[model samples]
Target: MNGNVPASTRTLRVLTFLATQPGPVPMERIASAVGLPRSSTYHLLKAMISEGFVVHLPEEKRYGLGVAAFEIGSAYLRHDPLERLARPLLAQLVAEIGQTAHLGVLHGRELVYLLKEQPPRPVTLVTDVGVRLPATLTASGRALLAELPPAQVRALFPTPESFVRRTEQGPQTLTQLRRILADEKRQGYAVEDSHITPGVASVASAAVDHAGHPVAAISVTFRTDAIPSSERFLLARRTRQAADALTRRLRG
Candidate 1:
């Protein structure tokens, strides 16, 4: 409380101050430098700790930026490059496939679509840029999830409650989801039928980084009537090709 300076402003000041430091700094110094009472600083830090914006090193009595903070910084730097590489590919995919295509990234346990493309005679779809959906439910989300380590996947979904419902489809438990992900991983692609919206289906593949971790997913969604389940893997293969192209660009 620096004479009515907002808590949000003060927290930002603390983050700015911490960013200037070479590494973690002790609480006393942070509170003093940010001009906040020690008690208020402690509470603010606790909140940040819960949200993964800050980490507490108990033995050293120090605080530092956490992985979430790192992700935010990395995202800022990556936004232009990732989108620049994917936009044209999505446009091309829509044109060639005559369907809707999208680029999605995982945000926490959900999929956040970052880019979307529609064919000239597009069918209206519920998914669009910035729309978030359950990772265990969408084809593209599963494609991304399939690339993550099993342990990380378990950590992301520890219990049955984590599985959300949409159109009464998709897995209801971690065990069931793992089974589906395993098949999708082995197939090198993923597919969903009416999992998000009724009468719609999608095929997807993940773009991997140099380290072989999934960086994003490319998916094409079409009406179930337009594409037969028996022949949907054709779309799957096409999506994989697009994803692989993006993977190479990211790797280079």
Candidate 2:
């Protein structure tokens, strides 16, 4: 790595550092971490704050990655080759499973839908692109949750009181959530019924990124009463294959 990069490059590096840190990082800490002069660090921070890449907390006097950072980070999804590359795969999964397919990323304890493929049948689902759903109440959420560390999961939900039950079937507490995630991990995917909408069942698998983190989930939703016990295995297998294919595309 070059010790002396241009000012523009240094500013970019500072933003990168703040992004990877997860939470607020103080100006002095940023200076020390990036090995920049205090004056330069302050100037860079001020500029980034103005540009919305960083936010300054007047009360705490600490700096954190801002909404602009989140937007910019999410923008990567728009141009992401994985989503484009995975569309046909999602359609194929829906075709094979005879159910709706969805691709969602975990966003601050929520599942943000990135893409969805609807089945051709008369009965369909409402997992439209760009819709956000509760991560704790959906199979896709559980599938992604299964890959996260217990501490990270705890940090995401904070408390049992924060858990919102969408239906009688959903997990009502953190203990229940942890147990569900553990089961999903053991089973290699997550399965849930009538959690989001009564009479609907879903199964999801985690789509991992290059870091081996569960970046997203691929799910299939169908009418609970319609899916036979014999077809459940096929649905799970096809959903897993879609997730695996998406992960491979993402890694490439």
Q: What is the lDDT of candidate 2?
A: 0.78
Kindly list the per-residue Cα lDDT of model 1 for residues 149-216, writing each as its tens digit.
66446656878888898788998888898999999999999999899988999999999876566789
Candidate 1: residue 54 Cα off by (Å): 12
* Candidate 1 backbone clash number: 0
Off by over 4 Å in 2: 1-75, 78-80
Per-residue alpha-carbon lDDT of model 2 for 160-230, expressed as tens digits? 77777667667777788898899888988899787888788889999876655577788988888888978
Residue 194 in candidate 2 has what lDDT? 79
- Residue clash pairs of candidate 1: none
- What alpha-carbon RMSD in Å does predicted model 1 have with respect to the real structure? 7.8
Worst 10 residues of 2 by lDDT: 66-75
